[model samples]
Target: MTEEREPGFQEPIEYEEECENCEVRVAAICQSCGMPMNSAADYGGGNEDNNCCVHCCCEDGSLKSYEEVHQSMISLFMKTRGLDKERAEQAARDYMATMPAWIGR
Candidate 1:
């Protein structure tokens, strides 16, 4: 059996605004550094303009270049895993290749 509502009666709809830049609608980790941020100003390093976290930006809020982030990650990986420079670079390149273009080459 089915029940029907009045002709003019309609249920309300819900909507959520996600980040406009990184395409991440939900508050989550930074795409580059794994830091947490969202669209809120108080927490998660959220920035509504470019849709990125605070640490990922310069003082002016411009996003850091992809190469910078990639190099940092590679260095971190090398230091933590004890990988040689050549091996770390290749591994980092391979890993970044599987990520979205936003993560860079």
Candidate 2:
């Protein structure tokens, strides 16, 4: 018999096949930045095992500090989105607040 989910519940995506460049299976999104991590190249340090994206990790394959990620996101918003410093900071905070890594803090 098929199982039924609760109201407003969503099924988790299950990745069964291994990625071409790494042993880890593809995940739905980066836990840190919410970026799609469909391919090995899209994962941090090019490893599909990472829960975060390349931008959210250091070259050594560790997750970046919260401040570092916050600053980078602010800078990115200011540069690419043409937001001013204050607005960029707010935008970054709002975005990061929704991410798993920064949800409570």
Question: Which candidate wins on lDDT?
Answer: 2
Which prediction has the highest TM-score against the true structure? 2
lDDT of each: 0.55, 0.76
Give the Å error, residue 14, model 2: 5.0
For 5-100, candidate 1 gives per-residue lDDT tens digits of 434332321123466687645545444454445445512234454444565566566667777766876898799999988888877767655433
Q: Distance (Å) between predicted and true CA of 7, model 2?
A: 17
Can you write out model 2's per-residue Cα lDDT over 1-105, one digit (the tens) per residue? 988643433333333456779887646577666777777777778877777889899886689999999999989999999999999999999888777667667
TM-score of every model? 0.48, 0.70
- Ten residues in sequence with the least summed lDDT for candidate 2: 6-15
